[model samples]
Target: MGDNVVVSNMELEKLLSMKGGKGEGSYANNSQAQAIHAKSMHHLLKEALDEVQLQDPNIPFVVVDLGCSCGSNTINVVDVIVNHIIKRYEASGLEPPEFSAFFSDLPGNDFNTLFQLLPPSANYGVSMEECLAASNHRAYFAAGVPGSFYRRLFPARFIDVFHSTFSLHWLSQVPECVMDMKSSAYNKGRVCIHGASEITANAYRKQFREDLAGFLRSRSVELKRGGSMFLVCLGRTSVDPTDQGGAGLLFGTHFQDAWDDLVQEGLITSEKRDSFNIPVYAPSLQDVKEVVESDGSFAINKLEVFKGGSPLVVNKPGDDKEVGKALANTCRSVSGVLVEAHIGVKLSEELFLRVERRAASHGKELLEKLQFFHIVASLSFAL
Candidate 1:
């Protein structure tokens, strides 16, 4: 948009702050998604806690949640874990150990908002120190750390559990090759890794390998032997990495169409559009398995792929305006900051506004058809 407009080092983190102000508009979608998906994993989650060693009655049970965004969406997952652990203690007649949980995200995450929202009721019987004091159960303590999950976040062998959801798909950064003007891998129109050049595809694959490996390596160090990590995140289809079966049908086509319209309106430069791509990669089931197996740190106990669930906050199912606004707000939460960094704030807002209009036209039926393949893995540290 201007010579002054450049991608700052902190821009990505700022973008993830969710609509910039301390408002509810941006984080509404991720919060909703977390609620829906957290329920689906209830059965698998319980099974994961079951595998975790419970013999020690006095030691603190530590759990670290990676990419925990700024709000109750995070608490929802923690509630699930604590609930299961409570059940385990009850069944075994074992003394409940102190539960220390850490919520981690990029330095830019709105952890202030996260902390403000952490009332006991939001914790699902997990966070109220007083409530637990009256009983025999050990208290649950929650803390926030700001950092990237691709690097180490805690001391070696100190953690008992690690959980990440809807977050690992993000690569550390977009591939350098795609943005270089001199490079052959210039992504002309699309924003994602799908349908890119061989060079671009290979670059993404290589980056994903390194990122996933680093993620596993760091976690392996922090997690004790027999510790568990349960991850639920986006994954590509078996037949094709780009085609998410019908998921694209529900949401992708409309999103692209709206962006194309913005280009036609001369809002965003073609050069900028071509060079800009999301830093996310939804790896295939095979891709995830290979990386986990090769890491030699964690033994895969369970790997299940399933679709996304219904919208939580969005009331009406098929209402075009409501659906469109919900979808637009969701994308705006994660990508809006980055878009503004490159295209200038005005155009970025306009772009997603158009996306809302476009999404509304698709109706809820099509949106429901959107593909959301998830990889729910219960991994144990290799002893």
Candidate 2:
């Protein structure tokens, strides 16, 4: 922290939210990549459930999705969990437990849109009013909780299973030293620690460590004994923080280039570009293991890194341009709001348009180089 550390966590919290609504630029539409990644963890999810000691049928089986942005992917995850639980209980000739699925994210998330998408199907929980009336027959009750996952969001030992996907990479706040011009770690000309100087990368790593520690501490308090947690997050293959091979780094480079284009065109000042940084970090597996081990609340039953599947890489005829556009849209859906906050709506639109163009132009090359590292882990309370 230095004199140049003017940006506060509160300011970042207010500004940093995914693109809301169901438009093309919205996170809901652009989250197919996330769905693809989540599907890869289906077996792990089952394993987590098998390990968790189920509560009596009378006590509702509580499940919470942290950072569950507005999308079908969120619902799909819950659907998978609920279906697995029911199947397991049914096969054993036991009554399935009542379900409560809580979708959580920042307060700015499009919860209304999320609620609207919740169908009355057997798998998808019906409306709260109807669920109450049909309590005995209803599959689950759905609710939305708005808060940061890095802090305590529920009462002590209230949650049975905690789930989060594609969320933990987002730091609670940008490291203060990186934004401080007076500090050696000041990340000039780069919007992320990716490809930045070692000092700058170290600063971001430190912030991630602190944020994750806090997250585990809070979740440990909220999770009941014998509870389980399943998490999937963006990560890097290389232990080095500056490794530029991960999909997150690729996306960061594209965004930084977009900012460079704006700076070069004289539409936005270099200082303006320098002032903005995404509050995200792709940790290595070692980084995550260290945090979990140090927290001492949860035992890591499974921790492995895997590559994204065929869905991420397009092989269709003449679909390179579409692939590029989709990747650009995904990037914008996640980071556009923050960009808009920093550089205004007009330039933000122009900036992402440049991203789309660049991605479309080099679609094949980009797709070939797209190595998205996904870390999936199952953890249970240590005692």
Candidate 3:
């Protein structure tokens, strides 16, 4: 691994320590979301596995979930694969093959949290003897490997099936130029071209392209010949380069507005804003295909963008009044963390109150414009 790719043990410890705190926010609910994603990915993988079994009856199967935060998703994936293998065996009148699972994530991921969630051998119905004899089943989890999906993390032809959800969009880090707070074009809290110049926008685009290319290249090596990979990540739509009235605009504007408010309140300095960039990039569907094809090893099986509605609206069990209350509660939970982290403990209460007032004034208008895309891409290629 290159120096930039290395994640030290100390850094991993620090990240894990920060895993469950006021600022954790949506990340704390990753387990819940992973379960939902696993359900969707299961069918896709089963189909791929069936295709593979048709070619080789007693082939060993291995599945790897990259960027598997805390390994919650890994367990669910393993459950699905095991069930699928059993069904495949019964249908084909052949014995089930041995299976191995690997969970890969940033060195800083909370592996302890993941391992704690695992059930002991008692949870597996088969006795140790039966498990050993009937199937060569093994499951393993590892962390702190690295974050670059564009680079090879595993040995060549090692992974049989690769899966990731909601994790691929995170760039390794913000572009280096953006890290310099002294740049004249820097707009601390805003990401849109309104506060930023065309140059900044183009710079972001370039960095995104490089990152996307790297992600595809890395996946090419690990996936075995004819192995399948699945990815579901945030995506954006292509607008006229000049037209800024879309999902990207809305998300950028909201985050920028929030940052601007904090800056005006003297919670975060202008210099800090210039130096910080949200480490997320939602590419268009065309952009995604371009990057994947650039690698030349993978063929796209499906690429569909589905909107999951506005991310801001919180719906809970209740009438309109109760729904509003639930929304408020959810917003408070989110804003509270943002305030404490981006602002400070001394101003967290006041900042959260101000944010609530601002949301009350414009939340609905904003939600109408806000959109999230769920892009699922399945790929297969020869070794």
Candidate 4:
């Protein structure tokens, strides 16, 4: 059980993708927190869209949702963009031009589910039914682009506006040094940098900077001269990577605890647990600003970090079990695939069940400590 297992790059790609489809454990059903976070930036998205000028009625105004997981949130975000742009054109006494909304994510993403979620109407469900009858302008077209956002996914200067939420924290992969047994940075007995050594944390930080810079570079080329981007990423209030208040560490610590349960039960070896590391890092506001400024591809229009209280929102206050389930499901929706890939389906199921139970046992305390950083930034291509 202690034997080392090497996972191929291809396997890592698939493993890192969010759980696909509309099943019980699917991301589509568990992305409420992300949706809430995105909605909190509705004004930012509107502001970004308002600055977008559709000069040609013939040319389609292109909008892209990078890291658009399979969920209503993606569609909802697109709907907001489309509606805002439509209204902006109308306010200017100009005819609204054609629109195109592209949803991009990794290859393993549930594109089938995303495409199916689209309404028959072309307006992205922004009251398209009424708009279709009221206006002669063409509705927006939808497409799925499957690939990593860390690389180019469109022609140079082709995209008009870009948006991403609950992403940007995911590195292209866990730092190689953390996975290399011979490396001093190897993260032993930890699934993330939450409690890892400074060397391992540094490795993760270096990888994050590289991935983010590459992402900005690719997006700069793909975006038009005046195009705008609104991004909302998981972030942290403290510079210290091990801060328990950091979103990544908060959720990750619980996950690591659940993984430890399996190890204690002898269901999996400690080495296996150590071998798996989540490729997520919550950057501080300064971390994001530095990367964007250094890249020099975009001008930072707005950048601020807000506290997003408990990812789980309980309608009936004091429902500890419900709160726990919500939090656990959100974690599983994102990390279930990785767990299942590492251990197996059965164990992964048991693992999350344990996650839920542990969370429920201390829901009140967990809820208080679950405050997450929501980094919202609005940017436009540099002159």
Candidate 5:
């Protein structure tokens, strides 16, 4: 097995380009289109920070956001935290503690995009400059740390609060048992006939366990003794080994189904299917508990499954008609990416139309099925 799966700069550019041009652009701009799960994550992080701050107000808080794509969400998270701190300071009649933030992600993630989003000069209120100057604070952002989360990337005892959202579920490689021994039959589009079942559902469970252990061990050495960690990840509710549907549903059922269709249509060769796996995994609630407990370094502070409500409905507030329109628009937007990836450019426009129509027909179903989990945990040991 490969020791690490690091996305190269070119690959990262390709992935981001699938969304359109430079730095989250339309996807990030559409407040209505942003994943509902992200907002819930923000809420959970705020609550965690409030709890941590109440326990010790004098300790300078250093917040690090992992897998912080393009740094837009990190900026949003920092904005919320700073605002909360100011409000609390006024309420308690105390000076605000120093604040610092670090944004970390895959080397391919657009740091330039994130930097462009930062204000040149902090504004009077809730501005980066004002917040830092007022609280004797500092902020820094960097990239180029790739591979599994188990590796050390920062100095010891440096981070006070670590936050990651909608990340960390990806496994480093496809299950080894899935590979065929004879002539790589599994890699030759014969997975269904041979090695597919060898790598049972429990394989993912095992991977999660190992990955989480590594993650916790690495974090334990990098976080301050009493610092807190907040992670919001996609998870499953069931643990039945026979439940392939459960595994497929959470990560990319649509993409998988689309891939199957493409194979039948000869757009993608069967050999490709046998050789590559999506590398996405959604651990069950039990799986999550088991992994966290195994680490024995972090304690669960808050954990809950959050459903992905219809983005259209969320954006429209109360208008059902507007909600429908917004949902359609979102489907259209996502289809653009799908067309580019699966269908060739020659058929991109036609495929997009087909996908949009399909989404219109099944949009509500997809919305109802989209759900994730928010896990807020705290670290209690010195690095």
Candidate 6:
């Protein structure tokens, strides 16, 4: 009967570790988009890493992959980066510096599951010094920093390469104002803002501004001059938030439908339904530029839009079941826990099932593709 998003981003992240889409896990079922994106962007990632090496040579190359979720995709991405840096220097007739790769996420992230997949977990809540002890060049060291990227996590000018993918769209939390019943911004009957209302859109945009500002400011202090940051996260095609054709809107419609079923069954109150909002935003390119330019910490090298949905939406349009599975898994990994907490696990499952079925039935109107703004930057200044 209360809003599940009332908690802070730190708290939400803690609750999500168990629910995070992990390798060989439920959430992983629909992360093909993320996996593909990682490999596809290998060249981009390498270019950034290579640039870092070219600029700063013979020093420990500290690489941080913020929000590094568990699985082979991360491993493959890290492997490419590690091997590239090593080979680049080797080909230039110089010894490769030690590579210290830091995998960061919230404290609640499944570090145990993640470390077992890559580096050994020598200890909990590790630091750079401890991570360095275990790292060897041919093998590089790996450490996990468990906390919000919204805050500064590394020392000033200590980082060389900063990379985040499929992350950053998650704001620290839903803008608190969206919950006020008297506020016109109240996103009634919607599970996410998704540009459903102008007030709601403005509220989300404001939150994104502050969060991105904090992120850029912190990273500016942490990275050296000319340091590179490659970010690939979900973003919108235009400045308008009300574009209703994206997957966020379509799936949210099904989420509402799911809640409607529960309301009919007297399982949840309309007040509760109207009070909730997802703690994330798919920002526009303009939004990112405004934050970065205003911060005066980085110079934009390149920015591009990436398709947000699995290409399968177009390739297998006739196969509703397959399309449904993709969309369902994506929704499940993101909001499964929130739904279970507020609406009950059984109803949560039913909600997604209803969505899957609905997707299956309306194969034609189910073209809910989304996109991301892939922006590349180099540190120009710092706070």
lDDT digits (tens) for residues 1-383 of candidate 5: 12122233234224421132342223344334344557656666677766554325565556777766553666777666666665676688876655656667655455666667776432212544454565434332222343335567788987777777656665544455544335332334432211234344455556657877887888988887656777766555545532433234422344344445556877556544444444446666667777777777777776666553334434433444443344434433333343344335554443333344444565556556543333334444423
Report the lDDT tens digits of candidate 6 across residue range 13-85.
Answer: 5665435545322544445667776677777677666666344455778778887765445666766776787
* lDDT scores in order: 0.72, 0.81, 0.54, 0.80, 0.52, 0.68
Off by over 4 Å in 6: 1-10, 21-25, 53-58, 119-138, 244-247, 308-317, 364-383
What candidate 5 gets wrong by more than 4 Å, as runs, is: 1-35, 41-43, 53-60, 86-94, 122-148, 179-198, 241-247, 250-253, 310-357, 371-383
lDDT of 4 by residue, 227-321 (tens): 88988888888788665355664556667899899899998888888888888888888888999999987888889987766676677547889
What's the TM-score of each model vs. the native? 0.88, 0.92, 0.73, 0.92, 0.71, 0.85
lDDT of 3 by residue, 233-331 (tens): 766654332222333543355445655676687766665444444445566677678777777877777777755444443443223343333233333
Off by over 4 Å in 4: 1-6, 123-131, 134-138, 244-246
Worst 10 residues of 2 by lDDT: 1-10
Choose the strongest candidate by lDDT: 2
**Alpha-carbon lDDT of model 4:** 0.80
Question: Scored by Cα lDDT, where does model 6 land?
Answer: 0.68
Off by over 4 Å in 1: 1-4, 8-24, 120-129, 133-138, 244-252, 310-313
Worst 10 residues of 5 by lDDT: 1-10
lDDT of 2 at 39: 88
Return the lDDT, model 2, position 264: 98
Structural RMSD, model 4: 3.1
RMSD of each: 3.4, 3.8, 6.2, 3.1, 6.5, 4.4
Cα error, residue 237 of model 3, in Å, equals 2.1
The segments of candidate 2 whose C-alpha lies over 4 angstroms from its true place after superposition are 1-8, 121-138, 310-320
